[model samples]
Target: MTIYCDESGGLNAGAMTFAAVMLSPQVAADIHARFRSVTGLRGELKGSRISLVERAYLLELFDRAGGRAWVAMARRDTIGGKPGGAVPSDLSVYAALLNLAVGRWLPETGGVCTDVVIDDGRYDPVILGKVREEIQAGLGAWGRASLAESHRSDGVQIADVIANSLFNIAAGSPRAHRIQRIIEPMLASKAIRVAELKDFG
Candidate 1:
């Protein structure tokens, strides 16, 4: 299986979300092809750019295609205990959330190997490398781990949608209801795992 990862929001936002979608290679490719054909979307498929109707269609497609996702969320208001308490850096927040989400959704089992692909953003190479090392260490004796860019990955696009949806829900956006409805099936099936962190220090 392959895990495609993407993030929504940032340190300045009300909340941050990291989402990962898991799918077999064949399924991922098939989903990408179907999405393009159905929506006629050119270039990369980003949630922020799509219409509500399109989002619904994509979510339904994911359900029918057996796609699974995991989401990690951190609310800025609840990050620190006090007004001036120590807070974790963005990279730290990401790494911790990622670790928790992966552990829950794709625990290190001596079975099929799982590869991870993350959206190409502004992450520092050193920090990203360290995160990769940590993940591999945690998965020792189960399977090897590697991280790659999602520039040309369709799976990552799917992850982006999940991240954005989770972010909206966490922020209590008006569109949350619609997004939740679209993803309710995944939640009901436990195909979409969520980790909400209150402390990052």
Candidate 2:
């Protein structure tokens, strides 16, 4: 199974959106449990700020899981109601980042693309479809893919919580940091634009 999680509408001029994709049910549970154990997050994950420590915990979990787990990002084009000075608008760059991250988790050969789940929200299928197509095309079209609309399952929900926190952390980290600096050119380039969840809706 292959899963996807993401955040949309945040990081620029709107509310932060978070999501994740899972490739295995058992692995998903293990990931969620580990997150809860490490972060002490209780109850529903809606509208919660996953702490920095919890974010770190998940990165470690993904690292140890050694499976296909990745984060796709769309930097906000504007901040504080002002035009984003210079973020690029290349979706492929972000898509490449997402693919590279997921590719590491998927097997190099004979990998079945069984699951490609995402949070069910107002986003358009095109956005998700574009990402999946890029992954498959860049990888292979034989990979099976599906979306988990309105994910009510416990495992998927938890994955969503974990994914959201991690993406926010990576995108919102201090500008002086390494990862932040690495992506700064991408973020400051003109490839980004103000996108709305309803655009996908």
Candidate 3:
């Protein structure tokens, strides 16, 4: 399986989220094609740019595609952030969380090799490159990690949606209530694994 990674939220929202969405290559391509046919998406499909109905529909596709997700969240009023004017340290925690999320699905035994693609939307190439290398060092011989722009990646874009949806819920956004309804079944069934980083700095 190939896992796509992305991050959402920040200190301004009192939280940060990093998510990994795992899917077969074919499924990822299919989902992208289907979503585009339905929405006529001209450019990158971003969670922040989509409507509630579209969000619901995408989640439905994820469900049907049997997509699995793992998310790590840090809740702190003074935590590292990737918002405007972000520092390199701001991505340290996010990288840690990304590692945690991807580790969840990695096979501990047997020979298994998986690809990890992270969205390079938040920081400059050099800093995010370091994060990619950090993740690479941990992948062992069974996994590979790399960074890609979300707009160019359907998997990364979907990862963004997953991260964004949960961020809204944890941040208590006005639409969280409705968004919760759309994803309640997946949460209940544990198709999407969400764990808050407890006692996190």
Candidate 4:
């Protein structure tokens, strides 16, 4: 499975949300092509920019296209590492939450190769390179991980919407009610699994 990842919310305040959506690259491209054809969106379909109806439509498209996702959030208060006025770096926090979000999809036994693609806008190339090694080591097999800009990855763009939709509610955005209403159907149907991380290990 190829898992596309993205995150929303500030690492320092409120709640931070991460999404890992599993789909093949070909399927991701086909879905986004439909999105562009229908929505007439010119470029870069970002979560924060899409309207409520558009967001719901895209999510439905995702679900119907056999996409599976895992989204997780952690409130600032619940996140660890506040002793001695120290806080976790953005990379550490992101990696931990990301690992928690996508880790469940990994098979217990090896042999299978899982590919991970994350939004690479945050960290530099050298550091981003490390993610592949860590994931492969953790997998103990032929696992691949890479980072790409959201504008370039259809699956990552989809993940951005998932993360942002939940973040709006988790962070108490004014659109919380509408976002909740939009996502409730999927939550009820279990198409997208949502988890809250109190202990981020």
Q: Tell me which of candidates 2 and 3 scores higher on lDDT.
A: 3
lDDT of model 1, residue 175: 87
- The count of backbone overlaps in candidate 3 is 0
Please provide TM-scores, in order, for all candidate models, with all chains considered together.
0.89, 0.50, 0.89, 0.90
Put down candidate 1 lDDT per residue, 1-201, tens digits, no spaces: 877778887656677789878887788778878888988998778787888888888887887888888899998777844676765677778887788767765653336677767665649777777777887777666555565565577788888888888888887777888888877878889778788887566
Comparison by TM-score, 1 against 4, better one: 4
Q: After superposition, how far is residue 69 of candidate 4 from its true place, in Å?
A: 0.5
Name the lDDT value of residue 144 in candidate 2: 54
Cα displacement (angstroms), candidate 2, residue 92, comes to 12
Clashes of each: 0, 32, 0, 0
Residue pairs in clash, model 3 = none
- Model 1 poorest ten-residue lDDT run: 104-113
TM-score for candidate 2, residues paired by index: 0.50
Q: Residue 18 error for model 3, in Å?
A: 1.0
* lDDT digits (tens) for residues 40-90 of candidate 3: 888888787899999999999998999989998876544443467453344
* Each prediction's whole-model lDDT (CA): 0.77, 0.47, 0.82, 0.82
For model 4 the local lDDT of residue 90 reads 65
